[model samples]
Target: MSTTLASRASSTASRPPVTTVRVALAGCGTVGGALLDLLARHADDLTRRHALRFHVVRILARDASRPRSTAVERALLTTSVAEFLDTPADVVVEAIGGSCTADVLARGALAHGRALVTANKALLRTQGPALAAFGPRLRFEAAVGGGVPIVRLLREGLAGQGVHRVRAVLNGTTNYILSRIERGDPYAAALAAAQRAGFAEADPSRDLQGVDAADKLALLAWLAFGADPSTLEVVTEGLPRDVDAAVRGAARSGRRLRLVATAERAARGVTAHVSPALLHLDDPLAAAVDEENVIQVTSASSGTLTLRGRGAGGAATAAALLADLIHLFQPGTH
Candidate 1:
């Protein structure tokens, strides 16, 4: 039964329409690459459910010649920052870590009034105020808690509550090393295992020196209590370069070793510090091990809220990055 085009028009006009969300991605490292894979793998489900389609319009990396097994079309890769910025995109995601180019990209994107998202704790720790000056178009959830939605919880869940303090176990590499030590492995052996599992970086100095966790703690204080990342003084103690002593002491005392970050609202201001401490057997943090994180927020109204999850790994971090991307396009997100 064939119908005229004019007669069939009314029947086909009621179908739903779809809109695509364009994204400009910077960096193709672990988190960035996994993000691409996630977006591609879930595109159809996301579109079918949320009416959102993510299209990575451009990617900025140091060396485009570097081999990658991502789904992104080769034509989208660019080594030129200028070209990456000039490309039209609804959002710019900076996952490249470091102070130089990544900061430049973040600043460029924000200055251009583009929606900016980042999974870079180091960059944010160094220039949070500068980047945030670009307004509410910026969102960063992965920078602090890997896959845990702690940032959103602070912003939305406890929007009106007065947070008095935040205590967290923020580094997965150290946690994994300490866990291994508790299991009878030597400190060096544990460190090697963490590296083999991809939890620790090639130069794990930052993670071991407590710099990485301290940076993440500062970011959390800023979000949860409105503290300034720059002015926030974080007293840091890298988990003893060798966890053997700490592990032995904890074992003797019947405690668990965990590097904890604390931020308290004091009359002077918020005081933040990161240190490796022995946790009692029943302490909430005692359960966190190998690539796991636990963040506890004590607020005036909300009492205490605890978030626990895998705190390391590209997949976990990429999930948080993807959430930020989708929320940028979600209705009433801001």
Candidate 2:
């Protein structure tokens, strides 16, 4: 019996034949550059563990001369979207943010029949359902929760669990700032610190205005409620004008201030909001300090499930992109 079991286990764990997945990457900034490093660092491990190898066939960058990772070969760089699309690739990973160029690239990739993976929540806020028309060919696991994998959890793991409510700390920048404020740092200092830490961008208007969280919440509403994200009118409220006072007050009351994005299904329809909310000390949302994200999902059957993880930075987003690539091109997935 032991010999038979050993044989079965060995067969199950045996490395399958390696499959090379060609990837056309757009943007070599933080997320894209991190992906290149990850690919190079894990080249051997990916093949050995999953029997898969990823080859970046083309890289679309605005300025090809910008200094980047040593793993990014200059030969693969292209400035023209047309030329980038012309490259033979199994997948196109879009890490270049914003709605304009990213939208163009996303539509172009799907039209060209190449699988698309993106971390562009802004674009998805307005065009998610349309891109999702391509079905499994489009994956945006990095759009909502950074490295938290909330998108996959809703799309795959809880597909039919009849999920009805989603509450999350979706904007890591704001969360980081708020956490700093809670720790006695002034709002400006907190924002500046977050910027220096790469948790906040130079122009963090979207994050500070609650637009970023609203965008992510819209995508989550779409996934959780089957609503069209483009049409969702989320009631958004940013950080308080007197944020320091609010944090001090909350702390005095044994509470924490967190920017919470929530969506719930009701008879009237799905209503969503992105605003700063106060939570008690023991609340899970309150524990999501700094750049950490916490998502609380409530479903009919699963009751309530919580997912928590680092929800900011390039490496986290890049890992989500890599996971999408593996899912799309894994030998037997199709």
Candidate 3:
């Protein structure tokens, strides 16, 4: 036998076989359901290709009887946070939206030394550093840009790339509304359409008021510039009541109105903001229509790298979570 093959065989024989990793998922909403579907559909491939497999051991939800896509066993569902945390899990995935519950679940998972994967931008932006300091394995890849992999780009691919600025359109709900309005639909009608499409929440004030963008940009600022989310003075302004008029004015000026989220380093610190702005006809951001998100990163050595993709919906968020899961289970898989 070849020497390399002998070494591989010896290593495999000596090490204990890695069993399927147990995962406790919080929230069975859109993103959670999509994740369960993804895991179920690709379980065999994940094991064979990456030597990784996950079994959803427990599901945490306010209503244990709520319908979920995964058809989880009744015994695996729980309404109590304590019960969910007590389950033996190698990792915890939090798709819950609120800050209060998400914070507790995140802290509990970290206290138990379990790897945490979350899609909660609000919690991460508000308390990420503190929580990340407690656990060495916390990841929030799905928080910022859905499935765009911007977090991985900042944390790993561009670790030494000296990124200086990040400009993006991070809120897909607002983008969808604006696109529809630009196409002659009224803002209210557009917003209703977005909610119908599952791109906007029923309470879309967060997205329409630019809070969602602010939260996402705050997290990105922390990752890229080490700016504290609480300390950063983020100026935010949403689409004005006269957004349609602004879009028309921009069109007359050969421009388009886009909700822009920008983070730049200053001598004092990093400055971040989200607001409606005009993009020239040829600008890449101007072409980002509907629910698409585009991020442009300027690095010292790498210049500008822009990523564009679907920025909302369950499938995209679930895909980001899957990427994070693969990274955690098989660091060399990517």
Candidate 4:
């Protein structure tokens, strides 16, 4: 019997091992649908190149009846968060953008010891420290700068280095609006164009009001400077009704109005904000146009590191999610 068992084990080892990682996706919106498409299209390459295979074991959506872009097995879809959390999965990706529900989903994932990746900046901005305290299995690269990988740079690359400041143009909707405005378009027309192109949500008040950028800046501040999100006073001022005037005025001055999100270590604590500022024509921030994002970090020794790339859209955001998934699955990284 022992000899027979040994021979069976050897036979099993001779065949290609079927290794699979289960993933629970808690949103089926644009970004989530893109991720599903990406996973299906790249599964073969991922298995061969990275020795990683992902099976989306469970999918959670607000409207389970709503049609999705990616064809998901109906048997795996669920509208109940409780059932979704109970499903067995190695990692949980939260693409839902809200504070209360996202916090609940993130906490559930961490409680089960599953790695959590999220694109919810509001939740991270306010509750990141508590979530990080729960464990080191939380990742949120898509929260700050879409597909820019800014979070990883600060967390891993500059782990030991003292990071002094982080500045970014983190909101793609506002960036698009600003870009159009710079091109001699009116604010209303630019905003309408952004909406038509799907860059801005139906109700883009959050983005235009600077709340989105403020949330991203708050999260970046906490990651780069160990600042408490609650303590960081983020002064947010969106594009005013006078934006048209400001844009024209800046053009005459050879400058442009770019919404800037900045965070710096202050004497008492960290200060962060999102507000429209006049940047010189040659300024790097001014050069970030048409949904592009640029993040600049100043460190004690590394000096300055700038990352620029597509900031939003389904493909870019989905790529960020894939990066987080790869990081979670990488050997010895967990």
How much lDDT does each candidate structure score?
0.85, 0.87, 0.85, 0.83
Q: Candidate 1 has what TM-score?
A: 0.92
Q: Per-residue CA lDDT of candidate 1, range 26-116, in tens?
A: 9877888889999989998876665567778899888878888757578999999999999987788998888899888898887876888
In angstroms, the error of model 2 at 319 is 1.0
- Candidate 2 lDDT, 183-290, residue by residue in tens: 889999999998888778789999999999999999999889988889999999999899899999998988999999999999999999999998988999989988
* lDDT for each residue of candidate 4 in 75-145, tens digit (9 for 90 to 100): 78898999999987888999877887788999998888888988888888788888999777788898878
**lDDT by residue (tens digit), candidate 3, 1-334:** 0000101111265443334678899987788888888899889887666666678999988887666554556688899999999998888999989899899999999888788999999898778899989755788889989878999999988887788899999999999988898899988899899998878988999998999999999998888988888667789998887877887788788888999999998787788889999898788888788988999999999999999998888889999999888777662432
Ranking of predictions according to TM-score? 2, 1, 3, 4
Q: List the residue pairs that clash in candidate 3.
A: none
Q: Pick the candidate with the highest TM-score.
A: 2
Which segments of model 4 are wrong by more than 4 Å?
1-18
Clashes counted in candidate 3 amount to 0
Give the clash count for model 4. 0
TM-score of each: 0.92, 0.93, 0.91, 0.91
Please report the TM-score between candidate 3 and the true structure.
0.91
Supply the TM-score for candidate 4: 0.91
Clashing pairs in 4: none
Best by lDDT, which number?
2
Q: Between candidates 1 and 2, which one is better according to lDDT?
A: 2
